[model samples]
Target: MFDYSEIRQVTSRDNPLVKQYIKLRDQKKYRIELGLFVLEGARLISDAISEGLRIEYAFVTEQAANKYPDTVAGLMKASIIGTYLIPSSLGDVLSATQGSQGLYCCAHTLDKISAADKMNTVGKYLVLDNLQDPGNIGTIIRAADAVGIDGIFLCGCCDIYNPKTVRSTMGSMFRVPLVDDMDYESVISLLHACGIMTFASVVDADARDIRRVHFSGGSAVVIGNEGNGLTERDASLCDQEITIKMKGNINSLNAASAASIILWEMTDEE
Candidate 1:
């Protein structure tokens, strides 16, 4: 158990650690440079701690401490170095969004499954190609975790540690396995090498209806950007082009919505 005796009270916003938290909260580049990210809200912090994430530093507002004493105490015990009890006003500087929960923490980013050989041969996977929206990425990660996807390959997606993305995952950020740095070509080649059928999700009428295709073992669906859909080259490289059959005039689904559907279909056994 982490030592709780190290908790300190901070009255000034100029505190170096406070500034560090702000940087990690707002700047993705800085987060990547330091290999750390900031998580806001007691629930987010608690969830991370429960996942065995060691908190480098925890900042809790006095108001939050009174409101969530047990959670605050838990943070004290989970923090690896120090826990700062700060005023509500300072919490604003640490928060990325309005109505801040007044709970925050800095933790190193989780190691992802980046090595090619670490991936198995017969597991379900999701490949995101140039999907930039952070919220969509987060929602898809949550969906992937719920549907028991084997892993997620983020090929040119936004920073998975984007504050909005992190919060949007609702703790699934800690649960889902990820490959945040792979390129499209590498992803496709790896999947094919492992004998996984690559399915390209598209809006084309000529594509195979997803309902008719059997999601056999070792399936991976490539979800494209929200606006541009799949690139021509990407679609052609895949084993099959698949589409979710829509009714009436509905031509396309939202990225997150579409991914959820495709993931369910891939995991569903007929």
Candidate 2:
């Protein structure tokens, strides 16, 4: 096992690896080139390990090594390649977190889910149409994972690779299959052909109440933008439009919150 003590200490900001890390952290190109992304904190690291991500190197503070020895030990054993004990100051520079958690790692970015011959039949799936908030996307991902949704479609929205989305997911980004570059028409036709009932989630349309809808077959729910909701084009594609009956005075629900409610109702028991 590699000792936690001996790895090269990176103090200078000019260190090549540190420079690369900064680039990857700040820009998207480096992440794509290295096929890697940075993950911070103990919880996210643990989740990455659980997802079987290949962690090439880990940087932890000595305090973390002592305080979370078991976590450090797992990081040591599971990170067959190596581990490093970085200075707290150095780790602070390396960390993307608002508050450094004493642990950080470099792991390959989640592999893209290919579109060709994509599996059409699924127990449950979600389609995001022009949803702009990264946090909302991440929360939807976590909800999808919790409710046993097969995958997600990010249609005409923000990039899934955005760091905020990854962080918000709490590592569900690693588990859920997501496709971003999808066309609306193709998505509708494909799901329809596979016997999946596609439901568009919107407010006060001639839509059915979510409680009344049957989730008996392969199912996919479509959620729209936070500001504008679903486009008329995407909305027209759904076999049905569904809405959660909100008793409160609010006219509509936030896209992510609404999605979680519907997903729980549709897939939680199943």
Candidate 3:
């Protein structure tokens, strides 16, 4: 257990740690440089603690610390570096969410999976191509976790550590293994080398129906961007182009929705 007496209380926004929090909340480059990302809200912080993620620091509003003593104690115990108390007003300024949950933590970023790591795993996977929305990426990660995807390969997607994305994952972000920022060609080569058949999700008449497509061995289903779908070049690299069947003028689905359907169909669950 953490010693409550050791908690440092900071009222000034000019505090060095507070400044670092602001930078981490706003800039992706800062997070990259520090190799740390900010997780806000009690639930997310608690999730990080439960997952045994290395927490560099934790900051809680004074009011929250008082109201939730047990939670504050838990955070203090989980914090490897230290825990600090900030004024509620300062908490509002530091918060990315609208209401300000009064709890925040800084955690080390998970390393991106390498080609060697990808080659060792053989199971269903999801490939995201140029997906821009943080929420969509997070939601997809959550769904991928639910359906037992072996891994996720992100090509030109938004930062997975983006606060919105982190919140949307509801802690699944910590559970999922992700390969970040690879080009289409390299990903395809790696998949093929691993003997994983790739299926491209497209909206074309020539594409095979998703239901009819056989997922025999290790497979990958690719989901494209929100507006443009997959680039022609990327779509051409896959073993087969597949589409979810639809009717009544509804030809497309949101990226997350489409991925969920594809993941469900591809899932080996009985």
Residue lDDT tens for model 3, 1-270: 334577988889898888998899889999999999999887777788888888888898877787667768888888877889887898888888898779988889986667555554458888999999999999999999898778888998889999999999999988888888678788888898888999999999778999898786789988888999998888889999999889899989999999999998988553
Q: State residue 57's C-alpha deviation in candidate 3, in Å.
A: 0.8
Question: How close to the true structure is residue 91 of candidate 1, measured as C-alpha lDDT?
Answer: 85
lDDT of each: 0.88, 0.79, 0.86
lDDT of 2 at 109: 72
Q: Count of backbone clashes for each model?
A: 0, 0, 0
Identify the superior model by lDDT, candidate 1 or candidate 2.
1
Task: Please give the lDDT score for candidate 3.
Answer: 0.86
lDDT per residue, candidate 2, 104-167, as tens digits?
A: 7777777777754666475688889888898999999998888778888888877666667778
Residue 213 of model 1, lDDT score: 87
Q: What's the CA error at residue 139 for candidate 2, in Å?
A: 1.1
Reference-based TM-score, model 2: 0.89
lDDT score for residue 157 of model 1: 88
After superposing candidate 3, which stretches have Cα over 4 Å from the reference? 1-4, 118-121, 268-270
In Å, residue 134's CA in model 2 sits off its true spot by 1.4
